[model samples]
Target: MPIDGLLLNKLIREAQIFEGEKIRNIYQPVNDEVLLQLQSGFLLFVLKNPSYLIKLESKPNMPDTPQNFSMFLRKKIKNAKIIKIEQLGLDRIGYIELSVIDETFELRNYKLYFELMGRNSNILLIDEENKIMDALKKGVSPKRSIMPGAKYIPFYKREYINILENENLYDLNQPFMGFSKISKNLFYEYIEKYDYISFVSEFLDNLNVYTFEYNGKKEILAFKPVNFKYDEFQNPSEGLLNFFELQSMNSRFLELKKRLEKTVIKEIEKYERLYKKLKNEEKEIREIPDLEKKGRLLQAYLYQFKEKTDFVVVEDWETGEKIKINLNPLKTPNENLQVIFKKVHKLKSKEIHLKERIKITKKMIDYLYQLWQSIDFVEDIETLMEIKEEMIQEKILQDKTKNKRRKRSNSKPYEFEFNGFKIFVGKNNIQNDKITREADREDIWMHAQGIPGAHVIIKTNKKEVPMEVLLFGAKLAAKYSKGRYSSKVSIDYTMKKYVWKPKGSKPGMVLYNNFKTLYVEPI
Candidate 1:
């Protein structure tokens, strides 16, 4: 749910400590967000959809080049002292009044207003006369204008009851201004099960803001909801900031997942198309043998052709069958025979080249499939970053983050323990290569047969592995493979000694022998 006026009330009360502080610095973290640096702390105003205002504990990363409004604010009120802060009648509009000395050494008064209404949110700098000097976003609405030199009009207030004074809590619907629907539902539900008057007394007297988890989502309010798991904070902004951070991280993770998936899918389609083209060429070249047979027949019947003709009928020496051969009427019989032989020789050479190309194309398709399947198992942004780095190294993606230095995380195989045995499964090609090449000579290695998948290793410590453990390893191999959705998948297993990497082969490409196969469903 978006931050409503009631929640803003709690935030403003906690932010009262900053009223006497001076604005030290201002930053525009993003196009829609602004940060106000002060002697005590930072105040962040998010002016995008689902906008909010929160007090930050530490300084956030700032853009190298400041935006127009941020630079304007810096020049106008760099060391302005905050004199007062107020909310407009439980509306989602808060303003901070400041006093600053100008170049003439005369005291000037200004106010910075933060309108936290979703989608229409904006921040404006207004003079003592309440004329807008500049705004983060400028526009003209039907009711008021937000452009420079226009009168600043606040949102119209609606009639609301003073809940603190009124004892009767019934008939509360959408009538109470600034109270969200979720808050009303929560209060009504609480009043049904417990003593309403006593609960209200305790909630109103409580100084801390509360965060609760309901239906797998985090919610913050002035009072904690009963029967829900909650975390308490002395400062209300902390709880709200934590919720916002988690929300932002989740959004970033999903966006990264989409972008990486799109890149991998593009590569997969390219290889698939190439594989199809190679197979088609191979099919055309397979007709080379038929052409060679025709050429030999023409050579034997060269003497039979006396005049230039377009067709000839001859009997096959081996099969005693009559066959028809088309002749080039303008050329001699011997020349026609020579032409057929030359065409056959050229086709024979092409056949060999096509076969080699077909083989290489097939391997590329398999490698791409492996990369595509690995994206589904990524649970966190860090793992996705590893995959992204691998793609960049392979030249599949551009190095967009080359200028930014980031710490490389050590990629590890997924480890599981069952029946006194440890099973390791590789999620990506790099991890697969690491596990297969680094496993002990006697340890067991497993992979799904005839499909792109993760490599699974069972740590035996040179001891004999049990059949149950082998089946466990096979299940993991199938589950992480491209055939994961199949009801039954074939898993091939062998000793690590029997597995060897081919010379100059791609990562995760290996040859194995003396292996056993088992059929099982993915777990």
Candidate 2:
């Protein structure tokens, strides 16, 4: 599940609890990942360098962090004093004030900020110097906004306040008028913002005493009123009323709050560890080009070492062509070396992609969790399929089909009409080939430039194509291609007659002349 608002609230509460604590030690486990130890008596509260993000994380593993950012954190803000901490209203924005001295004899105040990790992680540090020390995000700047050098500006506008702080639980039974109007969205909104569902539930359970129930032969509807009784012991016969009594007597609210806080802390720790591991693994993988060269050198050495008698002549099976094949008794050492090299290369590539996938997957999971917490929607197979397909397109998951082509039907092709023009998109390579061959010369054809993407054709029917229709076709082509969601993609468009598939070009590979390059960003 995505990290809910409750988890964030709990983290904020914990941060508040350790607000004025003195910094004991600070160290970076990986490049950007800084660990801050705050001493509150004997217990230490560790606030991870907020700049480092937990990209991909598993339950039993550490999350991955970006390399350059981690390095930046290690270089700067090492063992800096955390002066003051403040929560940004009810949202997941938390500001940690830090004090650091530069080369000149002067104390500089910096605010280390943390926003929730979503589509982007927006943790940043801004100093009194009015310069950006660093940011978890490299995107966006104060200059982009109207307010420049604003000390306390949030990354995004604050929309709502903490629900608990807004609602008065003390005067629960005042009128009960507002209580009945609370919808599921409001209930979940409160649940997300205040990590204290047990408290809310307990409060409601106690307030059930003033609840009204109506009975009828038809469908029976019930409305509950909020009631709070500070004094006088009531009978424990009422169902929800008794629950409140037990909750009050056992003082489980405090326990639940503690549990929630611990869970948030543990999640933060897990993310921190995963971020460190991923960063290190990525560093290792980035060294593969050098490793590949070394492997090639080793292969050359092994090949020469067994050149005397170990090599043998072999004939090709197709034509009985003679070829020198290494047949060392100890096995073709060079061939074996090449095999190992290939395996290493594959492993390195896989490791990098896997890390990226895991990171994206974690983000998606966190998103789903948050959505689930806010809504009572059941995640079905269709949603999972869409998510899987998205992941595959993102290269987070390997496409199982690879280069395989599906058989196409010989029946009439499916077509869509938009803006008084027929739009035909190929279902597969065979269909694409048929469409290109059979379509009128005047029809406009479009394809993703220099990539194995879909075939899109706009049936212009010997008429001048409208600019809007051309753009529509281009957008659709870009949207379906590998470059979909990218900032800019080049799409090639031309007359259908000018498009031809090369004799042995792979499926979806085609040559086109008199084509126009359309620079477009997909919708």
Candidate 3:
């Protein structure tokens, strides 16, 4: 419903007058409005910093201090005691007398000569000098117009009320024919101040008393005022009682107003928390590319090492036979190390992704709680469904349809040929298992000591293995292990017969004796 001027006037008429009330507190919720708590037994709210409007409502207790708009009112009208008040213009305007110090001042006046022009809505307070003491709202300072220092001429004309003083009871049943307007429009224009139900009730009563009819049917039958005895209307229909109940129920709409206010507060808190979490996660995700670049450099280094052309020395364990195996860089140490580090980087990226997912989950929890509190009907299940869809879109809730079956590709164990001998290095778990169980007893096995690293082996086919190739394989072992970045890593080498895996040892873990420790830093 539109808040008409008449309704505001009616409210002012009903407000209790405070003759000697003091301005105890004031609050300014916005630039254009002020709420004043007076020492009088009323809570007064003054609106329109641009136009003059004062509203008063009763409260059980007065506030100790001003809040929001009340603070501004105290500053403007300090220590002024109210003396007298007069209602004018059908209670629309109120003029007040005040006693300030020893001077009897008549300061408070509500008949503001105000104008709302486009974006410039201003309320000018003009004194006898035609000088504006202050304005509730400010307009643009024009070069040619009266401003802060200039003489004030009325910027706009004031509205005057014209009352129909001659109309009497006889005029009420004349179908308002003098206006030459539609009956509905005329009735509305005359009785528009009342609410819809009240207007309908009053109009019907007038029709019944006047024997007025529309299309040969009576529109109104009876009138029922707030204090009317409903039981006296014998044989009342259910329809009439239901209509009365609807009107009565509307008086309690203030409960819904309170619920709306509480919902707004909860939504504000939820949004703030979600925004903070997303901001932090965004910062973390931005660092992932840099880590990926580091992984690329490490992969390139291992690739180059595996591409060296040499004969790998291999030692047969059972027959003590040694032979030379030619090494192919693409299928040897370079390829194996590249694959191992790639898996490591992938695992690290997954960890970061999981962390981000957890953050989103927490935000969703807050959002759901807020949603539940704000909405009235649980039957509208679409809101919950929308939240689920959002989670899936953000990848917080994984989409099973997007999970593709991946074929596992195996990288053969690391091996290279140097000086007519065979050598082998294990890159990862599956490859380590294969290399350890398949190598001959005569082959020399090597691994980083007391560290979880790659397995290295040198084949001796009845020919003694070269020390340089053995050292190179040992260094490659250390480079691929958990201690790859350490200053010096220990690598033990022995015949394949001496190196053995226990029943269920983790890949690349083996027990060995008759081994030599080689301390090497991987190039």
Top candidate by lDDT: 1
Residues 1-523 of candidate 2 have per-residue lDDT tens digits of: 1222333443344345445565454434443343455554211112232211221111222246436554554445545666766656545466778776655757767776776544444556677765566664454464453132434355544434344455543333333221222322234444455534554554334312222221311110011222211222222113323333444544444453344334434544665666667677777677677556545555544534554355545444446566453443565556655655776777676785867766754554343322222112112223223333433443444666778863322433347777999987654444456677778988999987865455788988788999888888888777666677698889999998898876644334467899998988875
What residue runs in model 2 are displaced by over 4 Å at the alpha carbon?
A: 22-34, 39-71, 74-76, 129-131, 141-153, 168-523
Error of 2 at 39 (Å): 4.3
Using TM-score as the yardstick, the better of models 1 and 3 is 1
Tens-place lDDT digits, model 1, residues 1-523: 7787767767776676799999999989999998999899998898987787888789888889999889999988889999988877666788999999976898999999998989889999999898999999998879898899999887646466545555666886546656677777776777777867866686656556777777787778776676677788877787777777787888888898788889879988888888888787777677777777888888787787878888788898989999898889998778888888888787777777888887887877777777777777877777777777778888888987889986775677899998999899987777889988889999999999999899999999999998988988899999999888999999999999999998867667788999999999999
| lDDT ranking, best first | 1, 2, 3
| Prediction 2 TM-score vs. true | 0.29
For 353-456, candidate 3 gives per-residue lDDT tens digits of 66666655554454333333323221222322333333344443455656775333444555687777777766444456578788888878787776556667
C-alpha local distance difference test of each model: 0.83, 0.51, 0.48
